[model samples]
Target chain A: MSAQTATIRGWGFLAPAVLWTLAFFIVPFVVMGAMSLATLDGRTLVWGLSLDNYRELAGQAYLARAIAVSLEITLTVTLVSVLLAYPLAWIIAYRVPPRWQRLVLLLAILPFWTSYVVRSYAWLLVLARDGVVNQTLMGLGLIAEPLTLANTRFATVTGFVHFFVMLLTLTIYANLVQLSPNYRKAAMDLGANAFQTFRHVILPLTLPGIMTGAFLTFVLCIGDYITPQILGGNTELTVPQVIMVQLGRRADFPLAAALAIVLMGIVTLAYLAMARWLRLDRL
Target chain B: MPWAYALALFGFIYLPVATLVLFSFQNGSLPVPPFNGPSLRWYGDVLGDDRLVEALLNSLMVALGSSAIAVALGFSAAYALARHVLPASALWRALLIAPLTVSYLIVGLGLLIVVQRLGLGLSLWTAGIGHVVINLPIAFAIIYASMGAQQQNAERAARDLGADEARVVLLVTVPMLAPAILAAFFLSVTLSWDEFIIAFLLTRFDVTLPVEIWSMLRSGLSPRLNAIGSLVFLVSVSAVLLLELTVFRKRRR
Candidate 1:
């Protein structure tokens, strides 16, 4: 029947993607899980069922601290990104007309178009000892020499905000754009002012956007090894660095696998929870 | 009230890029100030570096190859989801989005182990394979988003007119989805080009631009590196500008 053909066609269309996911995502995860039960005897991983890697993951003080630190950083960064993004999303949605709004949206996305390495390097120059931040601060008598923004947590967080805010703003705007302005106008006609209208109607409607953006930013911030590696000094070790150290340097593949699995669990849980609360597909 | 914060944020964004642009004009080796005079030596230097050029080609090839393949797979997934209420629509949607939620680092780690065991090892093909893995889900999401907005009843109309499934899909569905497909291609290219930890961790000899740039950073700055970074930036800026302008002009018309 015609309906039967559509269904078969649907299955046919889905075959490649399903195969890709199972092969890449499902199978690799199986390998990682299998690997984490291993103990590396030099170059050879003596892989029979074992719990040593998980035990090590649980016991290490530094590993625990690094994971905690990464969680903390992810939370703060997500909050900062969303906080900054809201007003911009508001302005873009309700304030600007269509033509100008498109241009502004383009500008917001502009930074991400370039290589992230180049963008971070640009940040490095701006934050270095003789960098622009200190120069300007000194010019205004805010500080005598450079503020030591480079190779610091501040620098890492700043870089996080720089690249991430645009994505958050856009996600929020996508939701905000479809919203009819009449609700706000009706509220205003009913004696609600700008603050009340925003607080009551606008915020509630855009809650889904905020949640989606926040979820993404949180997941990305925690998993990010690059920004923290480039900017964060030794004093601010994060979870990804620990995994890198284990795998790259010590060749402790089991431990690295175990650590990454834990991170994956956290990310997967957050994603599922977000999807349950607000359909993540809309993102 | 919020104006001050907006201004501060905008300033933070622009100043670093401006400094990078200025330093590219520096005549000497260092990226720091105390410049003598403006020169295009760095730009020349960037163009001259063989390693950088190789990396550039590697990035372009991988991005184009992965984006094309991934977009095809993605368009299929999107079409399936949009056109049918399959046995488990919500579950299928969830599975499609799972990869997007997982970090690129995890995906990289996962794929590296699988492909290495299969004898593919680390090369441009491996990198392209890895890119295809991660980009497929995103391409699906974007195309599906556009699909939801489209008027799909036309396809049904075409189908009722005695057209075959392929004919309906080929004649009606694809033309409607062209813009979304192109946008997905652009997005995939951008994502592939900017992806760092994955390519850096996976590839050995065949590196992407971000990997090349990262390694160069460890040895410290050079006019050559800056020149390369600038070239990468210039290309990125043009691609983004072109994509946005096309969409904007289309919207206007």
Candidate 2:
């Protein structure tokens, strides 16, 4: 078929996806923008094109603190997932053969494929006051009393790592899979040791993968509601949880929208920064 | 890596879930264990738990309804985008794909607000409607991307051979797009099944599994929840394997 005909044909196929996106994705965002403007009155929103909600919520000390906490958690989770993922990803990429590598990668991803709620709920079982971790520690005679692990920042960090490390590992593995195995081999042939070869050859090649993994962790962590709600003690609240709080408990629609918008804004800015800094699209 | 590291990972990831499953069968109440002997009692308990059973049914109703409707609507979108050229096609594709990047909680809130503002009468049905609406783009994008690589000549040939547009679409195009359509349906079901926030915001007394599980977890974790998790695990694994074998027809390696 002619190129013109093919182009026309492609458009015919593409029209549905375009229309779907317009109706659902683009339309909802516009609706969300409108929702952010209206005020809540006893479980109902009194709609008037007013910034009163935004002004009220944005001015609050609570939002600012929640935003910071959200950022801190995102950064911490991003760092932790990356830290755990890179080494394991390295082993799978460089050391393991293709067949075993696939198995290892599958193992990494199997949990993610399982129910997320189940996994998050499972964290509760593990970290409960008289939970498995404590029982094991006490049985081992490591501590006199069962240490407080559940409903702490430590538990949240562990949970995030458990959930997201696979994402980092997979992203990095995809990158490493594309890299030339001979780069490290060449470096080693030139008198560099295994560690030095990896440092010089493998690391530079895999930076894009690392960056992509970190970016996913960062973005996903910021929007996370379940993990923080499950594991984050009353000591702190992430932005998403705060939004849920305003919506669920307080029935504060205006504030929830404002917080949702603010959360989106934070994610947008972080994404833009990462994209610009890493030239992620090019990678 | 050390053997302990792998063992630790297994402990972290599977241990809690396994505990839930084991305790679900335990002759006693709680997963905290000491030689209490196994029992099929928890399944009976879970079966007897009206709220949990109701939640599971509610989840199925939503997932099936949303997946079916979204898959249809998304098929339309994919058909148009992949076979027909709309203006600024790349931008349109990006717009559809953007939600995959955004959080579901935000998406849920955004839709709830929008539906309420439009005075569409927000409820679980409308929430299911919103889910279909949200998932339509995902289905479209996945299908569109899949069809993009195929040659257009097959459809042209079908048309030239005296088939009508409808017949050509059905026999020629759909058969070609079968794998992608299956992928889209499976993805939508999995997504709807797993999605917590949208269901939470949209439902009242009747809630989806994820939302129900969230409430249970928030109060405290129990092994009964693990039985539910294992069921979810079995469903996903079976679905993925079935799709990969039939639709994909590609080896994992």
Candidate 3:
């Protein structure tokens, strides 16, 4: 085939994907950006260059609170999931027998196959007043009554942490298994204690993995509607929830678009912060 | 100590799923504790519920349809980018993969706006479109990463033998990348099958399983919900095990 023909064939092959991305991904995103700047006049959408939605974000306490609530919940989930997952990933990667490692890892992430919405609902049931957790606690004589565990920020955090710890463990474990033993041996030979060796040698090497997992947890957790919506009990709403309310209940697409853009902005900020360490391609 | 911690974390992870499955057999109406005698009544009810069954079929259709499109597009893009010396391949790859970074809610919301503005009614097709949008990047990534010089040399040889491009792709290139393509397709199916936000946003009456389940949850608690949740969990777990025993195990070997 001539080079010209090959080029034409290449374009032919590439056109579909390129057009799909441009039409669905790029065009929708551009429209969403424009929608964010447009305002709703009563119920009808007024298309214009206005910052009313954003201005409303600052002026409205409830809306501003959603941002704070989302940020707080996301940060907490990221930190706790990382701290909890690191040790688990460490134990699995180093302590588990090689033949059993795959099984162990598989078991760790097995529940990830379940419906994401159902998993959140399961947490709701488990954390319910008459649910397994409170029943168990009372059965053990740890409490006189069931603590209000469900329908709170705590429940939301627990649900988020449950999902993310499994995720972070996988990422952190991948980082752990890739480390050459020579690094640890070299550190031990240099009179470094075990703790010092880990702190100096292993920790830095795995920071990338931890950060990558944490960033993912932040993005997914912050953007998620199901976990917070089901468990949060509408006492407070996350950004995604608020965005959904805008779209579902009010049909305020412009405001919803603005909220989505804010969400996109937060994720972009996170990506920028973790760009140095993110090995998403590795995933 | 590590064993104890590992066991504890394992229990924590499995706690909800175990509870979900257990309550699925509850004879009572509520899914709470005080497990009643083992009963398949709720399972029977779930199986008989026309809407839930319809939603299940809808979910399957969307999952399979969207994943097929995603895999086809992803494979073609990967093949072209890998085989041809295209200009600015990196830029093209980046554009294709850009959706991976964006949130699903964002993607769904974006499409929802476009669809609404175009005065198109929401349906399973719109939701499937959203699924394709999200799954495409993932499919592309997996297929693109697996495209290596082995396929390249094989395709070159096919071309040298005077095989046309289509024949070369169908016979040689596709078979060479079968594992990656299959993996991508399966992964996309699994994702689209359980995906909620996009489907919830994009679909109206002919909703997928997740949206139906969401509505079910809103209508009050029931073991029927448990039965349905358990059913989905079982199906998914079975698929995972099947993949593990076959495709993943073969790949590892």
Give every candidate's TM-score on chain A.
0.91, 0.88, 0.98
- The digit string of per-residue lDDT tens for model 1 on B1-253 reads 5556656666666776777777888887787765545899778777788888898888998899999999999888988888876898888877877787677888888777777668876887777877888889888888888885445788768867898878887888888877788888998998898788888878998899899899988876555665676777888898878876796468557
Cα displacement (angstroms), candidate 1, residue B216, comes to 0.5
Cα deviation at A153, candidate 1, in Å, is: 0.9
lDDT of 3 at A32: 97
Q: Compared with the true structure, what per-residue lDDT tens digits does model 1 show for residues A125-186?
A: 77888766777788889877667788888888888888888788889899889889799889
| Ranking 2 against 3 by DockQ, winner | 3
lDDT per residue for candidate 2 within B1-253, as digits (tens), equals: 5446655665666666566556666566576755266776666667798998888888888888988888786776667666665678677666666777778787788777667667676566866866776687678767666775454688888878998767888898788877778888888888788888788887777788888887876556555776677777777878877875677664223
Model 2 iRMS: 3.0
Best by DockQ: 3
Q: Which prediction has the highest lDDT against the true structure?
A: 3
Of the candidates numbered 1 and 2, which has the greater lDDT value?
Answer: 1
Candidate scoring better on TM-score of 1 and 3? 3
- Model 1 scores what on Cα lDDT? 0.81
TM-score of candidate 1 against the unseen true structure: 0.91
> What DockQ do the predictions score, one after another?
0.63, 0.53, 0.84
Q: Kindly report which residue stretches of model 2 are placed more than 4 angstroms away from their true locations once superposed.
A: A1-20, A39-58, A277-283, B1-7, B148-150, B249-253
**Clash statistics: count for each candidate:** 0, 24, 0
* Per-model TM-score on C-alpha atoms: 0.91, 0.90, 0.98
Worst 10 residues of 2 chain A by lDDT: A274-283
Which regions of candidate 3 deviate over 4 angstroms?
none
Model 2, C-alpha of B202: deviation from truth (Å): 0.8
